[model samples]
Target: MHNINYVLISLLGGLIVPLQLAMINAFRHTSGATQIQSTFFLYVGGAIASLVIALFVDGSIKPPLYQHASWWMWLSGLLGSFYILCIFLAAPHIGATNTLLWVFLGQMIFATMIDSSGFLGMQIKKLDSLKLIGLGFIFIGGLIMIYSEYRHSSS
Candidate 1:
């Protein structure tokens, strides 16, 4: 574990995320594919790359099938697929900045409720006032983006 440089790996992965997002939009336009289709291709490409690295660089042959995985893990994957599909379809049209704002706002709203856990049928921690204020700020920013888009489109 001490030999592993996790900080460097995380930094590289974080930097690549935005470049990958840009490529998703660019390839969608260039290849005449819908953004959702482009995103699916990108996910496939990423999976292949990750498999190669894990097999060669890490020299790991394989892990156990569904080792310690619960049904929730599979459900999470389905949720991720839908979330990615929605964002890819909407992001290009909204502009990345605006999309980011709206997505963040939505995430904050859901996250607050999830943290409270009453609505989701879970027993998670409750949110504080600070978190509520932060959620409010997120929505305010989203509204600003919407207003900006409305003004630009109308004019």
Candidate 2:
């Protein structure tokens, strides 16, 4: 069974995403920063916070074995930056709930693919009928959310 603590932590992480996006939006408005500038500041803050956490957890930041690292490993930071930029651009126009609904739906779909395929050295988890059903429900829910958001915005 999955650890309850980890599950709760994951849920908390999910909760934080929308709040973070909203805060970033507010920050941009208050600071009069462009989206790209705000994203840059966000990464700078994140890097400092991450470094502090690493130091606390590991006693020091140890260098990775660069020679053994795959080229794809370097793409994580770029991918994360792109994701943040997309969120920054999208949340204000779409509303956070609408943006997040689609984001969550996309994450679920792609994550399922990754798990099933065991891509990037992940442990293979066979995708079954139950998982497909769950994804279908999520997709339906996303459609409902889209409809609601459209009605709310238009009217």
Candidate 3:
């Protein structure tokens, strides 16, 4: 069951990502929107889709907007916009594969640190030396990919 879930998760996310890239590329060519703008539009479209589902399927038209949230919590959209902007800008210059390597490495580094320390209310998982070294190796691999891209571009 765990393997099945993993396969399904991979299949769904893999399918969505290429579709997103195509949409981003099309938006870039058609609207001349900045990367940031395209990402915002993407989220906007997602929000619309969610609204339709909620209204027609669930009969609830809105999230509990009345729920409390910190300023930073509400600013997640802005943060995501910045991240997507970086992704679009980087992916064109560096190949998508290389860009993803950087993004994944960054995420791994931050997530591992947070999870290890129980930061931000995450359940603490003490990072043994083995895990730390393994993560370090992953980060090094990502750096190598970026370096390869740099070298290729320079040549």
Model 1: how far is 6 from its true place, Å? Answer: 10
In candidate 2, position 55 carries an lDDT of 92
Better of 1 and 2 by lDDT: 2
Ordered from best to worst lDDT, the candidate numbers read 2, 3, 1
Question: Tens digit of lDDT per residue, candidate 1, span 48-113?
Answer: 988898888878867648968776666865676676777676776787777656666777688778
Error (Å) of candidate 2 at residue 86 is 1.0
Per-candidate alpha-carbon RMSD to the true structure: 4.9, 1.2, 2.9
Each prediction's TM-score versus the true structure: 0.72, 0.95, 0.77
lDDT of 2 by residue, 41-148 (tens): 999999999999999998898788999998989999889888999988988887898788888888999999999999999999999999999999989998898888
Instruction: Tell me the TM-score of model 2.
Output: 0.95
Q: Kindly provide the TM-score of model 1 when superposed on the true structure, using C-alpha atoms.
A: 0.72
lDDT of 2 at 136: 94
Model 3, residue 117: distance off in Å is 2.3
Local error of candidate 3 at residue 112 (angstroms) = 0.9
Highest-TM-score candidate: 2
